[model samples]
Target: MKSLMPYLKARTVEELWEYHTKLMQSYGFDRLIYAYTCFQSAQSLTNPEDALILTNYPSEYIEAYIGHGLFRDAPMMKWASRNVGAISWRYMWDDPDNTPLGATRRELMALNKRFGITCGYTISFPMAIKRSAAGIGLVARAGMTQNDVDALWEDKGEELEIINQVAHLAITQLPATGQSRILTPRQSEVLELVADGKSVRDIALLLGRKVATVDKHLRGARESLGVETTAQAVRKASVLNQIFIVDPGTQLS
Candidate 1:
């Protein structure tokens, strides 16, 4: 795998994608069939498999997986959804029941016929923000012996670690979308005045409430925005479009 140590510092998704592609290429397996699914409802599959990945795969392959519901049934997807680390199919054939060696494993044979994929390795990492898991699938043609798969995993474990790190970086880099946290009417009014630079005492007097009551509203606003400080609460409110901004100081009423 090409050195992704430098890309650990990359601030954008495109840079990370390029670094990952190069890493996969070094291993002679570059097609990354990555997908993200909610942990609570893997069956629901709100995000398309192709949507989460920065690198693109064959359109036919994408269509095939969705059309045939392959992601739902693939054992690797099941492994990835539950675990936080790397997994490969080198020993899957050793399973006594429904091993990949049998005719009942016709799904594997069908995949080989349709996609030119005979063997594959998998790595899955859980997403930090959402209760979901993200996985990267590396498939290759036959002749990759178990030793070869082990060697590749040993050689590329560091790269996979970096892949996980870069994924975390991308998640943090996402801009805060303009969505508002729901709040009570009084809470909204209290924060709105604070945004206009009004002090708590002044707000309390204007709203005909006790100072303690006004303070409670501000605290609730902070909790709602998931911030420690009032300024951060204000900024989050504005970012989520919960509160509209006024250049010249305006009242909530």
Candidate 2:
């Protein structure tokens, strides 16, 4: 873990991801899939574009997984959603009568087996804040057994957990990328005023624009953020740091 501190302090997000991948490889995990979400809800998982997802799995496999909606029923995904700790795939699959693997889940497992993803540990990190969670699945090299993975964990579990927790926190601090849309300057201004508790009429008066124009800007902001309401737009914008930045050279009127 000491060897990872320098990488954790890397100046760029890409550098951090690269070094973390190397660290995972040294631990006997040849492939990894890590994902996190800050806006998960009971109704739906956060938009994929808004989440930070990193993996070395084949693109075709991922496309198939998503295209078939397998993630909704994946056994490990279900476990990670509710639990915060390391879980062995063996425990979930080895004793079918006790664990009762469903048909769809069994099929998914079979698909994974074809890619040498038969055994591994999944670490679901404790949430650092409300409404956010992250997890990582470390895939062992082909031919490794459950007992082999268990032994590895017994020797380095504590260090690995710490490394993953740090990685999650670091990822949360980086900016969101590949968003569906970016808020325009006018839209950002409208949302900022809305965040400050200003009403549509107040914003129109303050900005010296027609009430319709103010409403239009607010609507645009909501659309750009992919939210239904202005309040949601404000929350998503704040999360993305789209507003509330204080420029040193520009004075507020």
- Please tell me which predicted candidate would have the highest TM-score against the true structure: 2
> Candidate 1 — which residues are off by over 4 angstroms?
5-12, 42-51, 91-108, 127-130, 141-143, 171-253
Candidate RMSDs in order: 10.7, 4.3
lDDT of 1 by residue, 111-136 (tens): 64576554557777656645556777
Give the 10-residue window scoring lowest on summed lDDT in candidate 1: 172-181
lDDT of each: 0.61, 0.76
lDDT of 2: 0.76
Least well predicted 10-residue stretch by lDDT in candidate 2: 172-181
For model 2, name the residue pairs that clash. Answer: none
